[model samples]
Target chain A: MARARSEERRAEIVRAALEVIAERGYRGASLGAVAERVGLTQQGLLHYFPTKEALLVAVLEERDRWDTSGGRDRERWRLDLMESLVEYNAMRPGIVQTFSALLGESVTEDHPARAFFTERYTQVRENMAEVLRAEFGDELPGGLTPERVAPLLTAVMDGLQYQWLLDPDAVDMGASFRDFLALLREDSKRSA
Target chain B: MARARSEERRAEIVRAALEVIAERGYRGASLGAVAERVGLTQQGLLHYFPTKEALLVAVLEERDRWDTSGGRDRERWRLDLMESLVEYNAMRPGIVQTFSALLGESVTEDHPARAFFTERYTQVRENMAEVLRAEFGDELPGGLTPERVAPLLTAVMDGLQYQWLLDPDAVDMGASFRDFLALLREDSKRSA
Candidate 1:
């Protein structure tokens, strides 16, 4: 029961952090506000994560944790990635916004999420490209390296989120992504 | 000569505003600091753009104007677009960062730049697709639409900018964009 309660508190802190950071941005968000959101004292919140940066890292991890558990079926990764994107955009527009603000600042060689984002982008792109390679076989053109295409895929996802965050109707992640995939396939043939 | 001096002052104010906003964000940047940067009184700064919003709008418009005139040759639009992107990522990183922050807030139904961004995205997408259509002949397999393709182009450009801003070396915009163009050509070939 103690361990379970601790887990609950951690989750609570992460949720509160997301709400606070979303509203206040990375620079403005404070432990006091997050604690207040959770009905805990600042000191109490510190028990879970000693520093604000830790809490931020935790919050991002929690978001990705939920994303990781989702889309279990490898066969439908494309569809699943698209669906997860829509759900993520709906559930936490602020997180996306905060990310857009912090993205440049966070890319330093020492930034906490640098490794995570780099690896995450790599893995997701390889997965998507492999699916394409398998579907089309050798006829699938030559130079379509996963490294080459992954950035485009990742960029579309990130860019579409920005657009959707602005005018939800102006950007359609799933449709746009599917169209890109189709276009990618077509482009592969043209170069063949 | 008086009008030329006034235009120069306006440019100075805009430059000062961009630096202040980059350091302090849209909210933290104040008229006083901007005025000080430009060696003008607050009233003088206000003479050009009366409100913060007006100043921001002017900054965004200036960015648009810069984009329109800077290295954007019409003959080889694709190469021009690619080189322009590389130059932008190198020279005006602050503009990209500020634009990301403002983009979220500006997309409301009635923000001053709402129509501007909306039309800008639409027009840019169409223009890009026309270039692709011209290169690939109007019909391509998978029944791809230019409307669909254009947004993807913008998404990749916008998204890649965010990533590159974070980690300058994460993806090479010129190389990746060039690769995308190659992919587009390959995809145009069909199974034959």
Candidate 2:
């Protein structure tokens, strides 16, 4: 019963964190404010998650937790899964705004989330390379090595987010992403 | 004497605003804190700029004020000029951090700069389409119209910035961007 109650409480806190991040962005969000929203003191919140970063990770993880498919093998992030996530973000305007704001916030100096994102990108880059290598062997179409194309994949994903967030009607992430993927495969059929 | 004094005072305030933004980011920065830095109250700060957003615009304008070439025609943002700006940003990590932070904060709801960035991107898309049309004619090298390719141009530039800012050592913005440009011209030679 205690375990169930704790799980329930954690869920509530994650919801509040999402709202807080949506309101003030990840950098602007504070553990105290989130705690207050959940009827817990800062100390009480700390009991659940040791630091703001931990809580933020929980909130971020929660975003992916309920998705169609995430963390399938932990290390190997499939391309289709990424496409689905982009589609999911398109449906959720609030989450798109919140995550975009968080990425923007993390680029600054000494931001609490700065380290988190920098490390996240590094990991993302490697995972992308791994995924590309797995699917395309050593090289993708046009002799573009997996290592060379990994950053472009992530860049297109994130860059499209900024544009989509600014104007949804003008740029469609799902469609635009498919077009990009098509560009990569433009030479693949010729080679095959 | 009064004109000179006011100009000098504005310069001081812009400098202070830069420091504040570096420390606190654009959203976290307060006009009051900025005024206090230059030994003035909020009212005095308002007298100079009227609103926080206006001050921020002024501060942002100040960033481009001393650039080698900006606002050449006010409406036309040249591709090479943008490339130069990327190189310049690499030289100034402080400026990159501040601007990247600003963009992040602007994507959220009701942020003072949110409207500005939204409008800016709308304008950027148009400008890019115009630039692409001017260089590539109505149809680009691979049957991709400027209208279709405009977002990709902006996407790659902005996306690379995110990657570059996250890890400078691994990604070279200047080199990577030129490569992207090369990819665009890939089909031009064949058609010609």
Candidate 3:
């Protein structure tokens, strides 16, 4: 019960932090506003997160966790990954906005999310490459390695999201994603 | 003389504002810091920009002007554009970071920069498309219209810059750009 309760509170704080960050932005967002959103005192909020930066880091980590959850079979992994990206962009637009803003501000060597994003991207690349390697293992197309293609895939998804956020009606993301997949196929064929 | 002096002062304020925003973030960035940077009083700084939001908008506009001017010619446009990107990233990494963070924050309809970004993007797309169309004239590639391709190209560049900033050594931007051009060439040939 205690562990579950703590988990629930942490989740609550994370959600509240997102809302606050979304509403007030990273810099204007305050511990007081976060506490007020959750009906907690400032002290109570700090009990879970010692600083505003810590709270921001937690919010990013939570997002990274939700994003990095790998639950698809190897055969359908690529589709599953792309679909998750589409779904995540649709569902968590606020987090996307907040994170884009954070990426700009958090450039210091020690910024909490700096390592997380770095490691997260690396892990995402490795994991994605693993899935692709598995899918194409013996039948791998072209000489394209997962490592080379993975970052580009990540960049395209991220790039598409930024565009979508700016003008949703402008781009057909589904078509673009399909085009990207087709390119991968072409690359694979060339290598083969 | 008065008008010229005012213009120079405004330019100074915008420059200082970018520096301040880069250092303290958009929300944390204050007029006082901007004023201090320009060796003026906060009241004097307010004389130009009026508010923090205005200052941010002005900084962005200034950056756009600074970045785009005398930077590209019809021939070697691709290389010139890439060099501009690399130069911008190297020279004002912080301001770029701040601007991106601001872009994420300003998406809301009422956010001060929302309309600015929206209008800016529209103009950029149109202008870039026009340039490309003019350059290619009667021989424009396949069904790949400039309207369809310009936005994607811009997004790729922006996304690449973000990745580069996160891990400068990790992303070989120049090579990736060359690869993008090569892909475009292949697509054109296949279409032809």
Candidate 4:
């Protein structure tokens, strides 16, 4: 029971960090702000996370958990399921804002989150390749292998997020993704 | 002669800020660092750009100018010219990193660069629509209008930048952009 309570508190802290990050961005967010939101002193917060980077990692991991939940399998993801995920993201602006901010910063060579995003993209691209191969055999309709197009798939997903975050009213992220998917489907049809 | 020298100094300062931002990201970059690189005091740098935000805006504008130079017209961007631009970007990792960093932070509601990116994208999308219409007529093979597909074009370009930044060796940004263009060409063929 004590361990369960500790885990619960940790999760609460991660959520608070997400809120602070969404409002102020990762650069502007402070541990004190997150601590105050969760009613903990900075020292007490350190007992749980040990560092801001650790808290950021926790937040990213938790976000992945939310994304892959509901019977979704990352390795076996289909386009339709991915569309649903985009739709789900559209409902959560705060989480998306925090994620976009961190992803942008993570591109810097020395950013603490650099390795995390790099590794994530590597895995994400591989998983995308597997999904593509499962749907379309050795080659896509465009004559490019799944490996060749995986990065583009990941790029489109992320690019849509950036545009949507900047102008939620103007960008329909889910619809835009579906259109890309349609293009893929059309290519497949041509090759078939 | 004095006015010309002042303009030259301003351009020099913008270049310095770009380097600083590329090295440390926008949040970590300081006016003092940029000033030191250009052999100016912080106060001297402020004379050209009244604030850090102004400097950032100038950098962004300079980047756009470089992107659209050489008789290239924004209102009439061809896919081939876009390909050349991507190739040009591949040659300048530093400038790309600074732009990506600012673009990411600009997603925040209160960021100083937010308005600049928002306005820039709005114009970019319109320009992309014109590019598409010039190539394809009123509708694409996918049955979407140029206006509908413009955002995806911009998204793909920006998305490719993020992935390429993370792993330049793995991602051939120019080649991938060309592949997307091929898809567009193929789509047009089928509809024709």
- Candidate 2 docking: what grade? acceptable
Ranking by DockQ: 4, 2, 1, 3
TM-score of model 1 (first chain only): 0.70
Best by DockQ: 4
lDDT of each: 0.67, 0.74, 0.66, 0.81
lDDT of 3 by residue, B79-171 (tens): 356555655565566666666666756664467777787778777777667666654443332335666656655666666666766777777
Q: Candidate 2, residues B19-100: lDDT per residue as tens digits? A: 8876766555689999999999999988887877767766766875565244556444666777777787777666666666
| Weakest 10 consecutive residues of candidate 2 chain A by summed lDDT | A67-76
Q: lDDT for model 2, on a 0 to 1 scale?
A: 0.74
Looking at model 3, residue B39 earns an lDDT score of 90
lDDT of 4 by residue, B82-129 (tens): 899999888877778777877888887688888888888888888888
For model 2, which pairs clash? none
- Report the lDDT tens digits of candidate 2 across residue range A1-192: 999999999999999988887676645678999999999999999999888867876776687556524456654377777777789778776666666777777776566777767777787788888887877788654446777777777888888888888778778889777666655655554457
True C-alpha contacts between chains kept, each model in order: 0.40, 0.46, 0.21, 0.57
As for candidate 3, its clashing pairs are A141-A188, A142-A188, A142-A190, A142-A191, A142-A192, A143-A191
- lDDT per residue for candidate 3 within A1-192, as digits (tens), equals 999998899899999888877676555568899899989999998988998778877898887666555545444456556665766565666666666656645553356667766766667677767776665663322334666656666666666666666777776555555455555565444446
Identify the runs in model 2 with alpha carbons over 4 angstroms from their true place: A1-12, A15-43, A49-54, A64-76, A135-143, A189-192, B1-12, B15-43, B50-54, B62-78, B189-192
Report lDDT (Cα) of residue B171, candidate 2: 85
Q: Can you give the DockQ of every candidate in the order shown?
A: 0.28, 0.42, 0.25, 0.55
